[model samples]
Target: MRISIIDTSSLGDRSYLIDDGGVAVVVDPQRDIDRVLALAAERDATITHVLETHIHNDYVTGGLELSRLVDAEYVVPAGDDVAYDRLPARDGYVIEAGPMRFEVLHTPGHTHHHVSYVLRHDTQTAVFTGGSMLHGTTGRTDLIGADDTETLTHAQFHSVRRLAGELPDDTEVYPTHGFGSFCSATPASGDTSTIGEQRHTNPALTSDEEAYVENLLAALSAYPAYYAHMGVINAAGPAPVDLTMPATVDPDELRRRIDTGEWVVDLRSRTAFAAGHLAGTLGFELSGSFVTYLGWLYQWGAPLTLIADDPKQIVEARRELVRIGVDEVRGAATGAIDDMSAGSALRTYRVTDFTQLSSGIPSDATVLDVRQDSEYAESHVPGAVNIPLHELLARAEEVPAGEVWVHCGSGYRASIAASILDARNRTVVLIDDAFTNAVELGLAA
Candidate 1:
């Protein structure tokens, strides 16, 4: 069997396309479906099965669209009623597709209907241990309809224990999620593990059964509030979305939207957006995982437009928007900021924070402390003006420019403050490290 593991790291996700003799089965796919389809076509393989271990909450699933693209059988665990087309899968139900033989095991704990598949090839064995049985820790049980943590924990323990007894020691284990994934907080950092290694070192199996239950529950990080709604989105299926890049909008058209109250998402590198962008556009640094962070920042269904640097970055921005169900990418502004000047006035500046401001004295600039009333009340630069970071979008006119110093408690909020002010066409100096060394200089003086 040939297996290709696709990782959605920024979203805490991983998936695979396992091929048994030129026929493929894709497991736990993300919204970006083209990559999976392209891989199958390149290898001359036909995708006969699309399997989802359980309904996930982190990113939208593309299983339905993938099945549509490949004309494959969409299989999910039984007991949950899902929309779109699907073949119900249950425990001990063996299915065959090409050379792949699947032994489905009902493994609940992560959810009431979670299942793991044991795949046997001609020469070797492998298990698709979904969210239920990960490398280190079990999937968190607090999501979906899981109300009884203790009950779910008990079910999880039994599920892991069941795997130990049924799957042989030599069976290599492939799970859908890894450590960084919110699916399981303490997922093993590495990609793959064998049943033998998990038997010996998987945290849940190694700990005492009772302790395992308690520790697993205690170790969980903060779960996202959107999880409940996402569960529905996953099981039901995502609404049709455009993965192809949207047509480019004139930069002048983009400015019009901002004027009418639409949000202009600047998906440029922080450095690029910091240098120059149209006024009132929100800057989000796009590098590792845009979809993941976008989901966190906005409501799942919020409408947004791309203010990318140019044509190429627009594709990246649109893909990210689809991943978290924020699919309305009216389109990107071609020549972005440059397009603005011919039609309307534009601006630029360097972003900085309190730490940067404290390090040096321009000796002839005004310091703008963009922190809140509460933050300012605790401590603020004595001579610095107070305008909290959140309010900078509207209060930019108050801060004096011409080598203006912008700062926050540390440098994070300060950079944002600087960016907002810079977007307003001011020459601002960053004082990110100002307070850290302010007293030392005074003493020296």
Candidate 2:
């Protein structure tokens, strides 16, 4: 028996491919299915099943398309109100693929329909606890709603305890969300752990149900704004991902699109974006956290034009955006901002350090903190309004009337906020310095 882990680092999500004597089962696949197909070919395995633990809220699942391509059964939780056809997986139902056997276990915590699959081959056992259990923590239960938060958190406690009590100590545990994922109540300690290790170390297992629910609810951070659309899209069935490069448009075409109010996303370094960019363009660098902010600020299904330094950056940006169901990439324009033939003037923002900011901020200027809510609660510059980068676009109007001074934990997110403020034609100052510098430089934090 062979098991392969497919880790998507940007979203901090994992999928699994378990192969037994040339037959395989795929669990919690991402939008890009090429890697899964390539793996199957390398192992000379026939994909017999594609399993989903729940209708994912973080990203689009490729399970439906992958099963269609491979002629395999696509299994989804029985209670999910999805429009597409799938094998209804219920608790205790067993599926066999060659020497491997998977038993379904309903675990309704992360979502009302969530389930875990336990696979066994000979004496070895492994459980794919998607969004229910993690290395040392459990999945966050707040994604559903404020009304269901306490209900789901309580459900999570029983679900986790059930796994620990029913499974053997040595059983291998593979969870879908953790390993730096915001989906977890806390950052995962490691990528993998056994039932025994998690039972001993996982806080969810040690705490009483009431305390566990309280702590779990308190620990959740704000998830991506794009998350609200994922479950609905998944339930309706997402379109197959198009891997081909988007059409390349000239400056005039890009200008025409922008004139019609289309979003122009500039994928460049924060420093590069601050130096110069197309006026009104969103500065979303193609870094690890790119998708998080992109999904946060971007209008779903709205036509989008991409501007990058090169073709490579556009390709990378598109790959990440599609995972969260932002597939309306109309076209792209590649070159430095100065090289574009469009008649519009290049725009730039003034970036200052903490020392300069500490000297004195303008009385009318608003200090915007673009970090997470938790980070703001820990320590923030005096008089700084907390509008996390992800929520800035929706709440930008709420910012007081004045020049906007934006700062994040690091300068990265502040740069993003600065760009948005610039697009809104607000005079902006980016505090492109570490947050700790604010305290050390004698600024109240």
Candidate 3:
């Protein structure tokens, strides 16, 4: 059987087109379904099945749409926890595609509905291992369905060992997500791997249970607040939307336009953005919900240009816009950071503790807390005002002006909040806390 691995780089999600003669099946498809259809047509294969490993939390799954287009069966592992139309998958069920056999393995840990399908050929075997097992890690069991992380962690252990032990020694492994994704702790480097390679070198397999769990939590990056809602979108899926590329602008013209009214977005890494970023631009770092934040900044669909230090980074920024449904791009600022800095107003501040903040909070300064209402009600900076990070744009009027000390649970939300205030033409400092560190420091002017 011939197969093609489709990589949608934005979400680090992959889909497979498994072709056995003129019949094919797609697994874990991302939003752009046209690509899959075109590929199938090119191979002169009829796509008859769309197999979902689970209801993903990072991006919309295109299984529903692809099935609609091809009149194919949309199949997923059988489970009562969630609702899905089409075919339900169960353990030991074998599907035949001419000469190829798809052997189902009910491996649930990353999620309860998750499944791993082993493609058994005449001589070679490959496993479409979604979140059940990855090259460097296993799935994150702490997501919605797997409530008790501790228990789920142990369950994941057995599931990994089962796959490693039972699968053919030469079986190749292909996964759905990658390193930056939240599904697996350390998503595999390449789109595919072999069971033997992962069994020997995968960190999660090598470490003991205690060490493994501790490392998983430590490596867990801050997922978007919107990730919790992604299950709904993935279940039903989205109709294919026309995605537009940003219009290119002359470097000088772009600068003049931004100065007049356009916004600047620095679509770089979080570490790159934290070190230094454009004044008044959101510091979200081109992750999921990046366009959500852009909407927060410019709901008017205001024309904006990008300021990616790396020339190729403009493409990355544009991908984020299309993912979240933001389409306004005036152009990208070209040339060196120094050239971009010229004739442009620059805003800069350092992250401060409550002690340092105490010296800055006064008539000219104000403190703003960006945690959710419940977090704020439980404990927050004394006298500090509330404006949950997500709702900042709509409630901008409620925010008091002047030099501001903004903060959230950690510093990520605070940085995002600070950008909001910065765009509103306010000078702000970030207080690295979810508590009254802002209040104690009196950073809000």
Candidate 4:
């Protein structure tokens, strides 16, 4: 048996294409199905089955669409009241494709109906624990609701133990979440792990049930606000992803959109965006974290537009947005920053590093730290106000008036916060440097 990992690192989730020379099975694919199709073609294998561990709460699942396209059986957890037709997967259900055999294990933790697939061949063994048993941690339990978090965490503890006790110690472990994904209960440790390795490393296995439950609950932080919409979309079956570029908008239309309070996002480097950008445009640099934060803070169903240094950036941004169900990117404008400004002078903010911050901040200048609550609690610049980047949009009024200087762990969130502050007509300076620099410079308290 051979397993090919399909990593959507931006979302920190991985899909798998496992085959035994002739037939393949895809597990937990993202909304974009082309990548899965390309992998299957490359392997010279036919897709016989597409299995989903659960109705995901992070991104739209491509299982239904991929199954339909490839004329394969779509398998989903048995109890979910989904809109589409699927092969109901129950505990102990066995699926065979060529020489590969998959035994369904109902591992409820990430969701009430989550399942893991144990793959077996002549001698090789592996388990795809979608969100149950991660490398070092488990999937977050609060995604369902505050009311159900404890119940799920308890179930999560048992689920991990069951996998550990039942499966061989040498079984290769492949989890769907935990690689920098908000879905993890805590930061995931390491990359590749085995059942034996995880036995010693995973909190679920190492800690007692009560202690594990308590610690998992305490460690949970804020996840994306957009997650509320993902499960509903996935359960109903997501539509085919449209990667085609949105229509280009001229500078006049772009200005009109911005003036009307529509979301006009600028996808460029944080430094470039801090230097000069359209007055009303937001700076969400086109990087791995771009889609996650943008989806979190975006006003759902709003007419969204994009501004970029190149059209290619906008194209990639659209692909990322579609994964989280940000489908209608109304229009886009790309080119020189000055040209996109439409006759009016572009707005600019001061970008400084921690060295400048270490020198001295003015007595009255408000220092805003836009990292998460947990991050700010660890350590921060003295006298800096803490409003997490996700909360900044709603709590902008809470930030004190006059000459606000903002910083985050990295400058990405700071640039985003700075742009929002700039849009509100506040005097803002962006600290575009790593937080480690502040500690090195004796600025962190």
Please report the candidate that would top TM-score against the real structure: 4
Q: In model 1, what lDDT does residue 26 have?
A: 90
Instruction: Using lDDT as the measure, name the better of candidate 2 and candidate 4.
Output: 4
lDDT by residue (tens digit), candidate 4, 1-445: 6799999999999999998777999999998999999999999999999999988999999899899999999999998889999999999999988888999999998999999999988888899999899989999999999898999999999999999999999999999999989999999988799999998999999999989999999999999999999999998878888999899999999999999999999999988987888898899999989999999999998989998988899989999999999998999998898888789998888989899988887877899999999888898998899999999999999999789989999888898999999999999999989999998888888
Off by over 4 Å in 2: 359-365, 439-444
- What's the CA error at residue 86 for candidate 1, in Å? 1.7
Tell me model 1's lDDT, rounded to 2 decimals. 0.73
Report clashes for each candidate as comma-separated counts: 16, 0, 10, 0
Q: lDDT by residue for model 1 over 207-241, one digit each (tens)?
A: 88888887887666555445656778877778766
Summing lDDT over every window of 10 consecutive residues in candidate 1, give the lowest-scoring window: 436-445
Candidates' TM-scores?
Answer: 0.78, 0.95, 0.64, 0.99
Candidate 2 lDDT for residue 207 = 87
Report the error of model 4 at residue 241, Å.
Answer: 0.9
TM-score of 1: 0.78
Write one digit per residue (lDDT tens) for candidate 3, span 1-445. 7879887655556789989789998988876677788999888999888888887876667777788888998887787244447777888888776677888888877776678888888888888888878876787777764357667666677777788889867888888866456566655565557888887866657888788777776655434444665676565555454444456556467556656766766666545554555555666656654555554445445677877666666766665554443456767764455566546645566667677666546776778888777577767666788888878877877877677888777666777777767777777777665445544455333
**Candidate 3 local Cα displacement, residue 122, angstroms:** 1.3
